[model samples]
Target: MGTTTEAENKPAESARRQKTRERLMDAAFEVFSEVGIHAATVEMITERADFTRGAFYSNFDTKEELFLALAERGYNERLELLRASVANIDVIMPTLLEQNPGSLTATELGPIVASFLEQQGDNRLWFLFQSELRLLAMRDPEVGKLFLQQKHAADQEFGNIIAAAFTAVGITPAIESVELAIVLMNTYEASLQEAIMAGGEKVQERAHELFMQRMLGLISQLAS
Candidate 1:
């Protein structure tokens, strides 16, 4: 066999680095969710990831950077869910119309919208991580600025998705798409927090039910 050239090694090295980074992020997410950012440490994350402190440092300058990366990852995941839901509208809308053959009402539309916004990850863990980020943002101006930037970016993307969904269904939003997106997101978060606070065996199910109820009401008021 010929000696391995540096050029040939680059791709494998890059893949290994990416794998290491992802594992570190996964460990950090769990540790941060269990303990707030202020309480969580690099050692805790590296220990959970089964890596050394050097590995953590090589991937991230500080825990704050990793925290922000996690936030971005969460936003991207939600955006992907929204995109996937919207992409399936041709299939989904026909089925909805077949079941109820008329102009779609809030009752018909609410579930479609909810399906797009639903989280694919552990809801409680995501909520906890978000709560921690919010607390940190409130305490540190730099973090707050960065967090708001990410939130704004996510809002814009979600707004576009919402606009597309409404257009697909032939509904005119009473408010700006971004404004409506913000309201829906806040409502979903509130519903989730309420369900989590109540603490039961079916927290996710309860949250979805509560969101559907609230969403139908909001849709009725916001769409024509």
Candidate 2:
């Protein structure tokens, strides 16, 4: 009877634990969003979660570990959204172009790019991660090399998608095509960064339209 009772309670207990973990994660994200990765700490996180200090330590080994987990989660979520969006690129690309028609009006790409900044989200976290990893590699030169190799491979896969989208003509990308694609990506990032810093609401408009036109032109070129 005792064993059976314990077994029955296990699932319930497991669910409660999951709930607490999620609460901590939510609180941590809120804190991280408010300031940044470096500024957030265990006390800030636990206070936000309404949990005790012990709870924080119980769940996460250290602040760095927690930060990495949070960064990883954000990265994974963004990747999922991007992958899903990419899957529907055939549909999403054109619909946005059709919808917005005013001066510097935001199209679908605007919202998509905004989703990436994630409001309070740390864009710098990923950049810092890569930089730190590279720095560590310079010293240790062991695990870091393999880790970077894997990451670079994954990055290349995403790059191929951009290249293919810009030159999906089944034809090899010409020097002009590659140059245009690189330029378009750089332009989009620059404009988005400016939009973010400027507090301007709809900065993706011009770059987006310009890029789309460029893509269409490439497509036409491939067809011709």
Best prediction by TM-score: 1
Candidate 2 C-alpha lDDT tens digits along 32-144: 65666567788899999999999888788886566556545654665565466556555544554355422212222333333322332344334334444445455656645
lDDT of 2 at 144: 58
Give the worst 10-residue stretch by lDDT in candidate 2.
101-110
Score candidate 2 by TM-score against the native: 0.57
Mark the regions of model 2 whose C-alpha exceeds 4 Å error after superposition.
Answer: 1-4, 94-154, 167-190, 200-224
**Model 1 residue 34 lDDT?**
93
Candidate 1 Cα errors over 4 Å, as ranges: 92-94, 100-102
Residue 164, candidate 2: alpha-carbon lDDT: 45
| Candidate 1 clashes between residue pairs 3 or more apart in a chain or in different chains | none
lDDT of 1 by residue, 1-224 (tens): 89999999999999999999999999999999998898999999999999999999999999999999999898788778767766776665678757655467766778877766674667878989999999999999998998898889888878877777777776777889899889988998899999999998888889899999898768887788
Clashes of each: 0, 0
Q: For this target, which candidate reaches the highest lDDT against the unseen true structure?
A: 1
Cα-based lDDT for every prediction: 0.85, 0.53
